[model samples]
Target: MELIDSAARAQQALEGELGGERMILNMGPSHPSTHGVLRIVLELDGEEIVNAWPDIGYLHRGDEKIAENMTYTQFIPYTDRLDYLAPLANNVAYAYAVEKLCGIDVPPRCKYIRVICTELARISSHLLGIGCFGMDVGAMTVFLYTFKEREKIYDLAECISGARFTTSYTRIGGLANDMPPEFLPMLRKFLNELPATIDEVDKLLTRNKIFVERCRGIGVISKEDAIDLGLTGPNLRGSGVEWDIRKAHPYGGYENFQFDVPVGTAGDCYDRYLCRMEEMRQSIRILQQAADQMPDGPWNAPEAKIVLPEKKAVLTKMEELIHHFINVTQGINAPPGEVYFSAENPKGELGFYIVSKGGGAPHRLKIRSPSFVNLQAIPVMAKGHLVSDMVAILASLDFVMGECDR
Candidate 1:
């Protein structure tokens, strides 16, 4: 009884010595680890996180409201700024959204071209994501390797779209122009070299002791939590959901290609990284399929009223001239209706809902950015983990503020 009383007194003394008030930490709208202008207010019990509040809106430019005022075609450039990492994919998603609203189907060739662009965008995006994930986890070699391949993708983007980063490549009805003659050859060469680079990166970080220890079993989100929290993209799949927007709702001719969605069993940071790595490989497969099955036809739809006529005809013919003038002065005349179309972007399901009141501009334009949805899961995932693990968690999420804040 004397020893038991002493033990109880010792326990109380230890608790009194060790415990204190919780701390409130600010992680930044400028911290490099945050990946962009994202700030998180973390409530901490020493180094362990008790709760997290993601404070977004630092990079907001009112993109949705801007879309309501501008023409659909005019807003294409703005889409580039949404997910700046995969501008081509953003352009494709927005263009498809407008096309769906207008009830127009672009030609088969256009669809295939779009698929090619979208997949390349996916590969490009995953490269940077994987590189940054490695960098955040202290694997610098992987970052260098992925960055080199990413540069090649940027070259391809510049070749195809005449803009490297914010590529406003897609149009309301089709592309700005057909693929340049040098594009396919360069793309083929890049594909040939890409696998080797991916393999190199895989060797560097896939089973690295430090990387694995830092990521595995850290920031784990259950499959149920992932779905309920509306986590999309790799973050969602990393939770073993297997809910890929491409496979579920094929867009931009994704149905024509065959690829696998990489789902994770652990739903941790390591699993998310692995999912991205595998996704890059699947994107390569889709790219190869698209290249082999390249179609031949008009790149743009034949709709004269909404689609601008060819330059040759516009100069010579009055009807074509008038259509061109209206297409330039105003935007395409979309029917009075509402439509929501989303594409499986590299980040996740990028959805655009348009409420059109029979005009060139939309009455309401709403963007469902995956970054925004995925960022919400941070609070749940970061709970009970050390503050240092926050870096890996944020990296695994791989979200950009451009789209999230927009």
Candidate 2:
């Protein structure tokens, strides 16, 4: 009877006393829950989070500073490192920013091709996001299904840019080259095959009791908080704010395509995951329309001063050769002006602000990275949730530290 009484008291002490003692825990700079060099300092009372603080800057990437020192033309490759998962989107966004400063619009063909590139990048990003999100929440089978589709995207990227990763495929006023002849049929085949994989993934996880229980009503943030926190992309949209830079202010032929922006009703982790899934479906529609309406014309702008001359002309004609030499030695002659351009990147809004002083390089450069902004909402959303719930929340936010650190 004395032993039984002692056991009962011990259980009560663990249940009540331990819950009252506060503890400070570090989630990472290298832990899986924080994901990619992010550190979150958590104040916990037993298993529940009382407060959380997110720490960044583990990468030490100085991409903005690099842009200020180099020629405008020289910075295209660096943008690829921003959202390394969506390098094509980064390339296009950077190109648009520079083009705005130069005050030149690329050809219709160029605009259409850029749309294709950006959309492809979007699909690829969302695929990896969904796959990892499933795996993060214990739906491991979904990861394999999504990656199979991603490989085809890599194949497409390789075909177009001659590199599957970090495709420095865009210039200030145009692309590296026109799309290869084989590209369209390949794209069509991919589009046809992708939906089935998406359906398979959807069936596996969308209503799975385990996934729903883990994700639903977890890490919720209000619409007001999202906007006030300056959230963009799926995080912002998941909060039911209907804002997409592509729709609000369309650039690079996005206006021509007809597609709906996916918005979530509930501002929770599950909503964010739903937004990404619907977004991929919308991307497929946009890709089909862009492919169908692919314009026929010069892929690059005709401006000799802004766009590089044809290689054959550069080799044969003295005037063309001079233009080529000037372009290679000195960058495009940008006027003294400041411009800010933001694109609806897969992660969110990737904005570039450039101040040019009539020179090859920018006088000032700043990047408004989505991941950095999205990470700000962690403390607000994470409070009052269990420590284990963080894995699902972080994966749902779907941030890449490459861009966040940059």
Q: Give per-residue CA lDDT, model 1, range 308-343, as digits (tens).
A: 677888889999999989988888889999999989
> What C-alpha lDDT do the candidate models reach, one value each?
0.91, 0.92
Provide the lDDT at 141 for model 1.
85
lDDT of 1 at 12: 69
Candidate 2 lDDT tens digits, 1-406: 4455777778977778546789999988998655589999999987899999998999857988898888887899998889988999999999999999988999999999899999999999999999999998898899899999999999999999999998999987899888999999999999999999999999998899999999999999999999999999999999999999999999998888899998998899999999999999999999999889898989888778877887888889998899778887888889998999999999999999999898788989999999999999999999999998999889999999999999
Candidate 2 residue runs with Cα over 4 Å from true position = 1-18
Error of 2 at 366 (Å): 0.3
Total backbone clashes of model 1? 0
Clash totals for all candidate models = 0, 0
* Residue 41, candidate 1: C-alpha displacement in angstroms: 1.0
